[model samples]
Target: MAFSADELRVLRRALAVALHPAPLHDEDVQDALLLAASVDEAVREAGRLRAFLLADLARYREALPGSLSGYLELLRDALAAGYDPQADDLAALRALRRNPAASELLARCRILAERSVRARLARVSQATATSAPTGPRARLFALPGGRAADDEPKPNPPAPAERPVPKPSEVFPPRRRPVPPPPPEERAAG
Candidate 1:
């Protein structure tokens, strides 16, 4: 999807601020917020490009003889078809516009589709690399990589400990007893 000049300028500014070492600085905070906003814009652009591509491809399919086989060939050589969008995907878009061998609108549409796919891929990759993991461990504890305040130690109150109680068994002593047996009964029986 094409970025408006203003949006591109904003992206550039945000990127610069985010990459700066002093994130705690006021400018850095503003930069971070701008970057977050840009993310939503990027998503919207991607959606727009996806719709445009699909519509173009449908048009191409209806117009050409052996168009299905031609698309299959394009798929097989898709990587060679091009993925880079140097200085924006202008060159690739131009190439699409020039293809008289195929339906002009359909070819352009496919180009738009490829460009959208590539743009989204790049954005997702960038986001994944920068964003913290949303796993259980990340949720339970703050890591060093988090914001500056996350590194600060929290204050905790000291606990009061009580003395342990002594057991009754420890203070008591054993009593001695005299034993009497069955000697008298045995003598009587005998």
Candidate 2:
């Protein structure tokens, strides 16, 4: 298998956490480990089939020694399983002495497989790079302009207000204060 024991263990742990999530789990968590093991076993078996078929196609070369279509089918399977038929894989294919038709088919398969691997890897790498965070500290810097750190929003400032001037009547209306007349005895003396 291409994966080491530790890799499979990590894969299992990840699967288990995804299946039955818990907060306080360590590297050797139980349920996740079991699920990971099961997944690893399945993947290993599938890989074996893919590798065997790819190897056979690379070793055989005949116009119809074993059906050009059949060889192409094997290559498709390998590609689907994430195999990259690059220089090494092509070298293996070149070693085969199949007929012209089979050779052509194998060549096409190799090209397609290589393309698929490259495209998928590119997508995966792009996703990883985009999601990778630089650091928490970088978020503290001030943005663009030299505005104050806590400046209030200025998108829409208060509109110019129009104060109504008071009319003379409104400013000084007649008062109803009581007026005191001269004393009654003074009036009688007069």
Candidate 3:
């Protein structure tokens, strides 16, 4: 989308006018309009190109092993054009992983697929986090007794039972008494 020198000049003038609040001349206005139209056309052309590439990629994928080389080439081009690899594309690449090119493409496609999954999950999580109720929700109907759910007294969880403390003797057995002087007598005799 390289702009012509004349279009660049017009763009710069338009920016200046936007910043400075000056009235655009008839020629400047016409140039700006023309540049805008050119940009729109370029965007449309890019979309069409993307659509064509995707269609070509699908055809190549359908052809399978017979079109391995062409499929790989088309897949590369599609990836370069920011195509999000679909499950079918990943499965096809996986099937052709015997090919070095297919293996490389499968790795790249896996990364793209993971990123897409993560992005979708992030969006869903973000939406749920934002839209989910944060406070106590109001009950639509009363309980069996016509009492609001919130108005009922909440039951408290049971307290844990206390265990009896073990005596010191139970925790640690008493040490045996030392041998009497008989040991010393025996040593002296020896």
Candidate 4:
């Protein structure tokens, strides 16, 4: 959101007062409160506008071929306004792919959808990385007779004795002896 020069001045003064903890003039306090309220109102208005656009887009999509042009136009506007394409939008565009405009929009929407998915994955991975436990975890189950599994130091298993590995010929012998070829086809005769 672009802040007007007057709003910027008010915001600067408010930040300075906040950081410095100085007594502010009544006028400055009122200006800061008004600016904050305006910002909140602007946010609410944008949300309402986005909701209306989505509802209109849905209506246009439902009207199908008859509203193809309007739907495409609204969809383009929605995309430009940072709306992520929904499954319904993708499906509708796929069904109307015969139209060049719909085809182009479909490609654009697919790219946007992929980007949205990647961004969500990145966010999820970031959250998981940040929130995952870094220390040793407690055991879920205990041994019988009130003994915890990790209470005692267990002895390591004994290693097997070293042995020679058998060659393939020793493991899998030939099933039968090789038969000699006929002596030169019986000197080229049957």
Candidate 5:
């Protein structure tokens, strides 16, 4: 899975072709397909490696409140493999806070955890903000006359007086139909 620089270059080129479709020569197409297969294999290998690292991390974690050095090393390896540190990791680090060997690593882990949290929050907030309604709008499909994209003429919302409130019964009427009994012969068979 570990590609040499030459392989990396080839992989990148193949990826470029895949991402940006253009008429490729037969040889180029074949090369890209081969590279794609290699990439898939590499991905599988990375996943296996990650799983092994996570297992190692768990072993170290369970041996914790001791073996700070090994735990920290495994923790770093897990992090490198895209493992998110959990509450248990934080708790363990906190317990090891007094260990001089653990102080720097503890601080580093705390920072990494915080940074990850902030990043996740920011991503969520960005998504929410983007999706949230920004006032009533019948956004123009085609450009409006003499209006820039920013000056989009939005449709006005219905006034409170204009908005009709439905009665509960009207909104959700009770079901009228009852379940019919099974045929006599069918019921007898059952």
Candidate 6:
């Protein structure tokens, strides 16, 4: 219904060729076809762009809510474009309740969000219960500098079997300090 000036001109020329019995320039026909192809390409690109925008908006909405992001605007666009809300989308809409239409969406998403949570909890419990011992389960000592000690490869256990195990006395000899006797309680310095 909405034709650009160039499109209208092309259409007029075509109509002229159709109505008036004359050989219109072959280049003009090709030009009109090319313009139509370009228009179709533009439309396809716009659709792809919209899809990308919608996907990004959903991702951002699902992420932890932070400072004023363009979530609401994206949501508005998505809703106008008839995007189905996911659990995260519902949660986001719930948080951003200024829009009246959000109430309906929130209600619809409540069950979805609950199911999502239950599924997550179920997965966590399953993992905890069924996880096989991954390389000796023990209370591992953490390393200095906040790194996990176990994560680092252990210094290749002294390759030779004759790794001289140092005796306790040799490794950590006792320290004998002379303890000075305390002065007689302030020597009755009444």
State which candidate has the highest lDDT: 4
Residue pairs of candidate 2 with colliding backbone atoms: 12-36, 16-32, 61-98, 61-99, 62-98, 62-99, 63-99
Clashing pairs in 1: none
- C-alpha RMSD by candidate, in order: 20.7, 26.8, 26.4, 21.8, 14.2, 17.7
TM-score of every prediction relative to native: 0.27, 0.33, 0.68, 0.71, 0.61, 0.40
> On residues 26-127, what C-alpha lDDT tens digit does candidate 3 reach at each position?
999999999999999999999999889999999999999999999999999888878899999999998999999999999999999999999999999999
Tens digit of per-residue lDDT, candidate 1, span 37-78: 777788898777656654554454444444645543442333
The TM-score measured for candidate 4 stands at 0.71
What lDDT is reached at residue 124 by model 1?
97
Q: List model 5 lDDT by residue over 3-57, tens digit each.
A: 8786777778777877997787887767667777888998898888888888888
Candidate 6 deviation (Cα RMSD): 17.7
Best by TM-score: 4
Q: Please, what are the lDDT tens digits per residue for candidate 6 over residues 1-190?
A: 2678888888788788889968768888797798778779888988998889887786767663552246656765775665555656776777866655566556655655577678889999999988867686788775575667657676665667667789999999999797786678865653
> Whose TM-score is higher: candidate 2's or candidate 4's?
4
Q: In candidate 6, which residue ranges exceed 4 Å CA deviation?
A: 1-3, 12-24, 67-69, 81-88, 95-190
The lDDT per prediction is 0.56, 0.66, 0.91, 0.94, 0.81, 0.71
Q: Write the candidate numbers in order of decreasing lDDT.
A: 4, 3, 5, 6, 2, 1
Local error of candidate 1 at 6, Å?
Answer: 9.4
- With candidate 6 superimposed using the best TM-score fit, by how many Å does residue 158's alpha carbon deviate from the native? 80
Over the full model, what C-alpha lDDT does candidate 6 score relative to the true structure? 0.71
User: How much is 37 displaced in model 6, in angstroms?
Assistant: 2.2
Worst 10 residues of 5 by lDDT: 141-150
